[model samples]
Target: MELIIAAGIIGLALGAIGAVIALRTAKSGTIREADNKVKSAHAEAEQVVSEARRTAETLKKEALLEAKEEIIKNRQAAEADDKQRKIEIHNLENRVMQREESLDRRNDALDKREHQLSSQQGNLDRRSRELEDLYQRQTAELERISDLTREDAHKELLDTVRSEVTHEAAAIIRESEQQVRAESQKTAQEIISLAIQRCASDHTAEITVTSVHIPSDDLKGRIIGREGRNIRTFEQVSGVNLVIDDTPETVVLSSFDPVRRETARVALENLIADGRIHPARIEEMYQKAASLVEQRVQEAGEQAAFDCGIHELHPELVKTLGALRYRTSFGQNVLRHSIEVAELCAIMAEELKVDARLAKRAGLLHDLGKAIDHEIEGPHAVIGADLARRHGERPVIVHAIEAHHGDIEPNTVLDVLVQAADAISASRPGARRESAENYIKRLEKLEKIANGHEGVERTYAMQAGREVHVMVQPDKISDAASTVLAHDIARQIEEEMEYPGQVRVVVIRESRATDIAK
Candidate 1:
């Protein structure tokens, strides 16, 4: 038993020893493996460091090459810039030198011109002194040749010139007068003829008494009424005179106021036609007649304005203008005459290149005073001007109205036109009538006035005393004096006599050269 226990202990001891040996060998093998791994890691670290150094060297080389190339480019650019500045400076220097040369040449030319001018000036001054000496010698020689001194000769020459100039001036004056007269006469005749030809108007003589025809003489009694009550009422209401005359069915209504006369005529006619004759009936009929006449006046005025191409006449002016319808100047109807004058003025104005419308307006209103001349106390022209001025007429128009009749001097072309038109209208053939006695007296007076002038051989009135021909003795009245004689005669006639239109005085100086060839 002891021996078996000893063997088991010995085996256990051997197994313990083997286990320790095996653990020591395993630890040594692990240490060898770790050492090999350490060597491999060290080798890899060395390769990475070497590669990093090579990459840094390559980058440094590339950067240095780029920097050197940039510096070379900058140096070349600076050289090019320096070369361009040098070329510009050279061009500027050449231009400056050329300009200096040009300035020097101009200065030399100016100096030369100045020297030439100075030389010419000295020559001119010497020549001027020589001319002065020559002129003085010539004046002395002339004065010595003539016995008279310079002052006396000059006075004699001036007197001779004055005498000759007087004759020449007279001739010139005569010639100018002839030329102006001829031209003005021709132009006036043409315009007057044209205006007359273009306008055709009818004028009838109007009397202050308007004759109203009744059915019978029996009705005249009724018109006169009981104790002339009807006639009195008519005259009072219509402001017209009722004349009951034995004129065979005609009752005369007389009034200087054409409107009143017209109203009375209408009323009388109505009373006769209606067979109603009484105070009350007369008043009513007069009222009706007045209204009718007023309407007619308005219508006539409107028509006249329309004919004249005027539309803006004041209402009162239009009415006043219409009243001219019943008025008369000479034997011509005043309204028709006014219308004719307006047309004539317009035509003449158009020919003369004046304001035709304004002329027409003035012409139409020129005779406006004639319509109320009985009521007003002045020249019709002045009254008409006042009327026009009151009605907001322009100052120029008012002036023209006032000057149409020569009551005032004409101040404008319009005034002259109205005057011409009025004269033309009044003096046209058949425009007016004069009593035979008065006509003969006027013609005789015209002839007498011409005969009364000195050197008058005979005188003849022609064209209804509108023209006078005076025969002058050739020995008494010279050729130039004949013109003066004619003017004098015309002036005398104008002052001594009143005539329509215009009068032309012609002086005939005939020199008889009688020779007998026997």
Candidate 2:
């Protein structure tokens, strides 16, 4: 029994130990599974942090790129605006500069005018004092010499007034006649205006230089030639100057004579084409060119006469008319002006029922002397009259040409027509394109010359400086003094002023004596 009991205890201990071992084995397996779960969670957290960092880095890079683009855009916009402002400021400066220059010119003119006025005032005051002293002396002398009283003088003045009543009646009749003459004057104005309106002609201006273009700069040395002999020959033959400058394949020909200039142009063109430049070739080409120019001149003359319907002009007169093509007056073509004057004269003569053909002929040849005035002396009008006379023209026509400028005084209707036509042709708008400064200077000079004379109350330069009228005080100047003043003023104007045609001087004086009966 005891053995059995001990065996039983051992079996129990063995069973308990087996149970403990199984439990310990199951505990170990649980620890291993927990460790595996912890490791998986750590790895997942690391992966999430890495993905967030990558997203942050991409956002930072995008923001930087956007900032750089915005900066570049703003800079471009600011630069464009700045450029625009600068351009505006520069333009404004230019306009302001122009206005300042104009104002300066105006101020200078004002100063000059003020100085002239001050001088005139001083002269007038001194003259007035002298006249007052002279009048006082004259009055005293008369009072001392006369044996008559105031009552006798009054009675004599009444007698003189009674005797002047008949003359006053004639004056009233003259006033009535002037009132009736308005219709005739109106008709005359209509005719003149009609003549001006019907005439239309173009004016051409000529310069003293011509330019020749070459294909290359290599031709410049050839034109000058070796040792400059070719250039000298060209100058002597053509009577023109060869201006070889650094203007790049260009040569300028300068001459006072248009015919010679035209010849040189043609000849130079030929020589440049022929490529043979020498003294001998130059002379030969110049001769041919001159012949060509002569032929062109004749053709031009014939065309001019045909256009004017004037067929019977002398050949010499025709040639002179052609020469006028090269001449300019105040930037107006002389030949064209002559043609316009002729047309105007014919129109006016037709309206006035006069000889239109004779008027046209005289008008066309009126400025003939201008063609050779440089080679002759005396006035153009007088020289032209002599030319017409020598060319077998009618005496009346020659007189018309001379009298057109009033050098000989207009005696016939044709003379008056020529004068009127010439004035209209020259004074029209755009006919004489004189600069504004020159025009102002001419007017100022006219006033200056008139102010120089004594016994002049006031002076006015009228008709675009074509006439100057002087008014003299009656107390300071008598009628005879007025006539002398007119002559003196005219002579002074002739000596001092440079103008075209003629200027008429009119001096007017009026005396008034007023008495109140009351």
Candidate 3:
């Protein structure tokens, strides 16, 4: 029985062991199932995460493609905008070019129209001239038809016409004068007034230096100098005539050369002033005075150039110009006259709208011949012209100088203006002096001279000696004959009288025969 109990205990132990193993196996199976579920859950979570990541990637790719499409659209819009802008710019340029071409065409048309108008105006002016000539002829014919003396009819017609025309002419003149008065008066009156007022200096007389007066008779004795040695030396050296006459306190120094005369004057003045009037003193003073006079002459020439606004004169030319101070023409101081003429020329040039400086220069040189005429033996204008040409004066100015005295035909308008201005200056009132007796005698002589002409019926010297008006018979004096008569009168005047300036002779060839047709 004890063996059977041990066997049951063993069997029970075995059975317990089997049961423990079975429980352990069951716990192991539970653990394994829990691990599989956990693995499945992790796998599912991983799959969901991978799916979300793929979806996000797809959405981002779509957004990027849309952005790329938008960029392409903007780029296309920009290209289109550029193309349109180019087209607009090209159209604007074409429009501007078309407008410019139109303007050019319009300007060309205006110029053509203006030219046509000018041509038409010129034709109208020519027609007006012809009409005026026809009217004048018709009036003359009407006068001839009247049954009265031609002169009476002409006079009556003239009186009636003058009454009507005078008022019209006066109105026209007033209108025209209103427009041009300031300018015309400025030119004429202002210049004339300036010339008159400025040149109002009393005419001065110039004389040949024939005499040099001394302070006392004692000076004469001293100038004669210790048995006539000083006087002889002075006469020999200076080539002047010295007369220690009985006239109290005076000696005479005479020389043909004004330069020599001036030299002698200075020498004598020095000798007298120094109270050393001997032959030796005379020689010393003569030398010094000669030097001084030369210096003064050169200075005078330079001064003249300076005063006249002229420069660059050759030194030799200046010396010659200065020599004019000692010269005179027709009792007028030549240098003074030159200065006056220069001023007058400037005024005239300004008035007439000419070159003032050139005019003045020509005027200054106009009478330059007078300075050397004694030596040159030619007309003053010709000599002056030659001298000016030699001294490198402009050809025009030289021509003007030669033509001033009518030595040559005036080639330029300026030359004629100069001649006229010269005449005016010399012929102005109080410019030249003559006694009343001489004036009357001159008139009578002129009348006689004109009457001596073949056709001259009467003669009158008007505007002083400037104009000589002569009445000639129309039968004897043709237009050509009148010119010849004028020339002859001028020649006679030149031959008979010692006139200061030019004289004009005008021959009037007119016939007055009154016949009453009635």
Candidate 4:
């Protein structure tokens, strides 16, 4: 057992020894692998550090190049800005120098002009003094030669001029009268004769009072109505006066307006015929009568226009013209008179070679104012002229209408023709009439007007007061003065009198010289 034990110990010892050797060998090999790995790691770390250094050097070089290029760009930009500023400053200096040169030239020109003006002023002052002295010397010389002061010579010259002008004016008046009479008298007579012959219209006598025949006297009370209601309503509505009198079945309707009278007449006649007279019935009848009259007025206007050969009249104008059917002037129907005047105007216009249509139109409408003269306050001629103008008549036609009555001066040939036609129509025999008393009064007035003038010995009113003959003493009135006297008397009559048509004044002067030697 001891021997086995010793052998086991020894084997153990050897195994231990081997195990130790193996352990030492494995440790040394691990040490060598560690050393190698350490060496490789150090090498790799050095290579990465070297590459990082190279990359940092390259970035540092690029940064230095960029900084240098930025400095060059800045310097070039500064140099270019400085060059542009210098160029602008040089141009400004050139402009200033040019302005100073132009100002110097203007100043020199102004100084030259001032010197010339001063020279001209001095010359004008010298000339003015010379002229004043010359004028004084001439005035003194003229006073010495005349042997009279300036005031006395002036008065004497004025007196001579006044006397000479008076005589010259009188001579001109006489000569113009002779020339006008010789030129116009025969032509005027012929035209007037032809117009009168061509137109032969009948005259109608219309009065303000229109008589309505009632069937019996009982109608008067019915027409008057209860408590005068019917008559009052009639007057208020128709604008007419209802006059009831004991004239045997005759009730008179009176109004200054012919239209009102005519309307009232028709209404009363209708009321009497219908036999229903009350305030209501009267009013109804009045309205119907008014409408009927209005229609008649329209028709009459149309007919008058047709007769006058004027178809272009406005509707309102036609209606107004028809109103003349009920109107009258000095006992003559105004419509008939107007138609006659139109015909006369047309005939005279044809003879004078003027506008016959225009003449006829003016004459037809010349008395248009008489249609409404009672409502309006003006001369009929002016009123008619305004009416014609408002209705689109030409200015010439309006002027002719206005001037036909001598309301304004007759400036045109048409105006004269209208005047002559109006006169001829009014003054023809039986064309217009007045009471005997008024006729005698007018004749006496005509003679009295002529006798009131100077240098008149006697007066005679001829042609039913159409003309006046005045005898003047030859010793008191000269030939030229007679013509002036005739004109003055005619003008005075026109201003003072309201006679129809025109008046003729003849101032007759006879000069006689007696010889007693045989």
Candidate 5:
């Protein structure tokens, strides 16, 4: 039994060993399968990772391109904005510069005005000091020299000044009418009145436009030929406007210059009278008209001088004097005015014991400059004076002519007499028509100019702006100051005014003391 049992145990151990080997083989197969699966998964994961890397690279490139494009666009926009800002800044700078320049000009003007005011103030102060010193000396001398009190001397001085001024002014008037009142009161006026009545002239004033009467309106078409050439040629030759319109039986001639108007009128009238209207014919007629007008002017000039009982004037001067016939001053015929003034001057010179013949000659030639004033510049008086001097006139007559309007100071009685006669002629009631607004403005300006001075208390413009009366505060203005003030005012008026006549500036300084018996 022991042999059999040992054999069975050996068989059992063999079986056990076999079973262990089988188990090991199955576990090895499972591990191999797991390894193969894990390797395949690793390969798949590698492929996925490679594709993802390619996609990431492509995306990165696209993003980089977009970012670059964005950077470029931002840069361009920033550059454009910078350029616009620069332009605006430049414009603002220019505007600022212009404003600064304007302010600088204004400042310069202000500085100049201040300088002028300061200079005037300095002159006024110096004058005041000098006047004060003179007054002190005069007061001391008066007190030492006279037994009369200051009030008595002051009254006597005022009386003496009044009497002297009145006497000198009245005596200068040469009241011939007053002197001849007993025998022939109208003798002095009769001379001028008779001259006016003797010399009969057409009172019709020449107009800028003159009417040309034609035979019929059909003639207008001939006057204005094909393409308006005839009219153009006529105007070119005549130097005037020819108006061809619906007006019946007439044509019009227009020009601003009176002499030109007169010439054109005569030219047109001759063309009408001849009835041969063409450019060549118009030219011929115009020349003839000019010659005719010149002859007429010469006749008128010679007759004017002869009628005034004056002779020996320059031939050119006589012609110019004759030209005044076409000139009108304030609706009074300049030629007529001149003749009247000459006659009046002759009478006044006879009364004043002056050169009557010289006075009449000067008066006739006084307005000679007016003939050519339209062609020249400057005052008529100054121009006439120059003409007279150029034509070898006497120095006294030349001076009298120049000083007739107070352009120069009157140095002789003849000068004064001429001035008076000119004033009388120019200032007749209907001689001039001053616009009311102009008159008021002139009066206001005269007052304003006088009031511009220091120490003036009140200012009055009187005698239709011929005189300025300034009343100064006695305490502020001295006797010498009054005189200087008058002179200054007169000078300022002359510098600024366009008045036809001289202005008399009178400054009054009154000092009155009163003791009431209350």
Candidate 6:
């Protein structure tokens, strides 16, 4: 019986161990399910956070888009405001213009009415005066025939005659003539003053030579060339005098024709730059220089014509006009003088109510004769007129050309204006040059005159001999005497010498009376 109990205990232990293993496996499966649930909850939380972030980003994007739209809308509104303002401004300007035009029209109408009223009033006054004169004449004729008392009749007749034949008739005639003359003189003064003031250009003398400063004296030998062959060839080709004088590093190119001188100058500068002094180079430069001078001349002529409001000149005329760039008359450049005269004539013609176009044309062509005067024999005016006539200038233009110098009768006011303007330009102060000798002579004459005056001790020519300052003996000459001496000197200068502008005479009386102690 004990052996059977041991076998029962072993069987119970094996069954108990198998039940514990089954229970442990079920608990492990439950823990795995809980872990899976926790993982699912974490995933859901992450998904919610991501959706919130996306919504926030989308909201921010929408806000930004609205902000941009607002900015654009504001900008568009501002642009619209500006556009509306501009339109309003334009409308206001138009209204202002319309108002001004209406005002101008009303003023014109009022002026017209006033002029008509004035004319009618003048006509009525004239008719009333004529009727009174006729009635007085009838009464005078009746009184002369019916004389009652001789003395009374005579007194009555004298009173009637005195009223009829008063000084008022002569006074009226004189007043009318004076008004006409004053009007004419006033108009003339206005025209002349306007012309002068408008064209008041500073005049300068002309020269045919240009001095080119060389880099050094060494450049001179190169220009002279080997045995002076280069210089000879240059002169032959350019027709300019190359004056290599004592002047160091400087050479003078002289020619009567400034164009030729300029051509030579440019060619020389080019040759010096190239440093190749040869006959071939000289020829090449000469040809180029000739072409350039021609071009410059053409440009000068075109510029002059444009500035003077003259257009459409013939090619030959243009070329000839350019030649004037080299020509000068009485210390004033011919080209510049022509332009000034043309402008002055235009101004005068306008003020005088004459043909401005014709005046300018005549003025411009006035000096055309000077271009060929060196080559021609007769007076420049006649020669220029002949040349213009050949070139198919109008008869009026030709006449003006001849008449500007007072050589012929000027039929048109254009001719007179040109003449007057030319005279004004030429006769202006400092327009021409006086020789040094002549200037010195004038100064000496002025000094001698001042010295000849009583109580005058010494004299000096001041202000380029324009003013004479006389130092008089103060002991002999009073202040009043100094003034008298000044006037006398001025009178002497005026009478004895023909000077430019005017000369001012000044008398200075300075005295020194000293007694040295012995």
TM-score of each: 0.64, 0.54, 0.53, 0.62, 0.49, 0.51
Q: Rank the candidates by TM-score, best first.
A: 1, 4, 2, 3, 6, 5
Q: lDDT tens digits, residues 1-518, model 1?
A: 33444455455445544544544466675756655554554565456445555666777788899999999999999999999999999999999999999999999999999999999999999999999999999888999998777899999999889666655665876889889988798887788888999997788888777887777889878777788888788778888877877789887878899988888888887888889789999899989999999999999999999988997899989999999999987778999999999999999999989999999998888888988999989998899899999999999989999988788889788988888888888898899998899999999999988898888999999888888888899887777667767877888888988878788888898987889998
lDDT of 4 by residue, 7-80 (tens): 55456556555554555567665756655655555565556556555666777789899999999999999999
User: For residues 1-518, could you state the per-residue lDDT of candidate 2 as single tens digits?
Assistant: 33444455556555555554554566665755655544554565456556555666777789899999999999999999999999999999999999999999999999999999999999999999999999988877776788665577789889788546635654564566478777587887788778878777778766667889999999999999999999999998888999999999899998767777888999999999999999999999999989988887777778878888888778888887788777777888888888889999999999889989888888888988887786798888999999889989999999998998879988889999999899889877678777789878988888788778777888888987888888888887765556666767788888887676578888878877899998
**CA error at residue 466 for candidate 2, angstroms:** 7.8
Which 10-residue window in model 6 sums to the lowest lDDT? 1-10
Candidate 5 lDDT by residue in tens digits, 298-360: 898899998998888899888888788777776567887788778767777776688989888
The residue pairs found clashing in candidate 4 are none
Q: Write the per-residue lDDT of candidate 6 for residues 1-518, one digit (tens) a residue.
A: 33444455455445544544454456775756655555554565556556555666777788899999999999999999999999999999999999999999999999999999999999999999999999888777766788454567788889777655444544554567589888797887787777778887876687767798888899888888899988899999998899887798899998877678878988998888888889999999889988988899999989988888888777777777888887887678888888888898888878767888888888888988888786788898999899888888889988988998878888888788778878877767667676789778878988988888778888999877778888888887766555556767778777787655457777787766799898
Q: How does residue 415 of candidate 3 score in lDDT?
A: 95
Evaluated against the true structure, the overall lDDT of model 5 is: 0.78
Candidate number with greatest lDDT: 4
| Candidate 3 clash pair list | none
CA lDDT for candidate 6: 0.80
Q: Could you tell me the lDDT of residue 148 within candidate 3?
A: 66
Report the number of clashing residue pairs per model: 0, 0, 0, 0, 0, 0
Error of 3 at 362 (Å): 1.0
Q: Candidate 1 at 247: error in angstroms?
A: 2.4
**Backbone collision tally, model 4:** 0
On TM-score, the leading prediction is: 1
Clashing pairs in 2: none
